[model samples]
Target: MNEHLKVLCSLTPCFYIKREDQASIIGGVIEFIKELQQFVQSLESKKQRKSLSPSPGPSPRAPFQLSTPQTENPKELGARCNSPFADVEAKLSGSNVILTTISRRIPAQIVKIINVLEKLSFEILHLNITSMEDTVLYSFVIKIGLECQLSVEELALEAQQSFCSDAVYVNDI
Candidate 1:
């Protein structure tokens, strides 16, 4: 019996060394006792667990390395069309639209503005508010539904009327 096996047997009562009658007879009782004693002494060291299965091989393909380019659109020069809302930039992209307005009083006007857009059947996706020295403006990136058919100019005018004044001014933007 291996020394590690002997210790494992003593610690765990489930294991036992079977006595072979012919081998025990040849060794004699005293020799058999000495062999068992040697086995117990060898078991003082710990037994290492062995794995039954072999390790897996490395993968064939290399991992993906994503390289994103760092670039920016060229900044355009020239005085932007000047108006009281000169900072506003509105654009329609597919089903989505972005409306940016620069104003001094937008914070106090957001709720009314959104209500007007809702009335016009525009569905807002996101709204961002920004400010400068007592004036706050908002940018809304909206998803206009498939059923929407109003012109951007008309919508802008409606928004102006909804937030800027009580009087609805048609045919003007």
Candidate 2:
């Protein structure tokens, strides 16, 4: 019995069967293989559909417009005028920071920001940028290594002073 058990363990086939129950085990193994094949085929079809889908591009619709209030408030007007360079917000989770920036779509702004993060010795885990008309939004997930010495507030302040002076607000999540 011990030798038989060893032989069964060494078998590389999907299903092992005792000599007394070969028929039932074989049937079960066949059913499992069939289901696995079907699952693989479904996954292949999903991949094909995703590959055929259209890539994201700028919208064909008209540019966004903010409605102006009829009442004359200088504060309101100023806020509206400066809406293009809004703010930067960062949220820290574990060693990862989620940074969001909304500002005017200056060319190479994304590249410049990435360079700053790399200079600070932070690893960028993910980055996404979206643009609508003149406005651009950036979302970045960055890993602050154990060697990083700067606190979250310091990092945010440095980012604002160095590259995003136009940002009117900066906050952590």
Candidate 3:
């Protein structure tokens, strides 16, 4: 055998890592792996839950794109209105409706949105606002009254008209 091999074979126990330290490190790694596995499982379960959700309402369309109106009423600005929002979407969640509006930070526009909601007989349950760089997101959880007969299309058209009427310049929304 080589001289280095002989020395390694006969080295004192302290020359190598302690078994306890090795076990501790291995245990920590195992624990981290287990935690990572649990996190993945949680994400998968969330996807499963989303897939199993109920069929959508009568007027479900693409989230970002508005559906074409069956009839063209002179009063309604279905898709012609120039909106400032990067995205405007609404969905029914449980007993409330969630309206998500993404736009550049326009403080006055928020008040207009709130007024629109109040005018529609929607009770605002919660509002979540998030700002990122130049854009801001507004999420409103609104409860529709049982007596209300307005459809999703009506709500959208009314909101759009409100903006269109208020806008004096071409750049306004």
Candidate topping TM-score: 3
Scanning candidate 2 in windows of ten residues, the lowest lDDT window is: 75-84
Q: Which lDDT tens digits does candidate 3 get at residues 1-173?
A: 35543343343222122233545444444533443453345345444644775643111222234663332334422231114333454555446665656555655777888888887889888786766565565667689887767766566655555443443553343
Model 2 per-residue lDDT tens digits across residues 90-144: 5564457756566556677787788778888889987766565655667677898
Q: Which residue pairs in model 1 clash with each other?
A: 104-135
Q: Name the candidate, 1 or 2, with the larger TM-score value.
A: 2
Clashing pairs in 3: none
The residue-by-residue lDDT of candidate 1 on 1-173, one tens digit each, is: 55544444444222112343434333344433442443333222111101322433212132222222121322311111113322333456445665555444644478877887788788888786655454455667777867777666555555555444542334343
Angstrom error at residue 53, model 2: 43
Looking at candidate 2, what is the lDDT of residue 170?
29
RMSD of 1: 34.8
Best by lDDT: 3
Which candidate do you rate higher for TM-score, 2 or 3? 3
TM-score of each: 0.44, 0.45, 0.48
lDDT of 1 at 108: 46
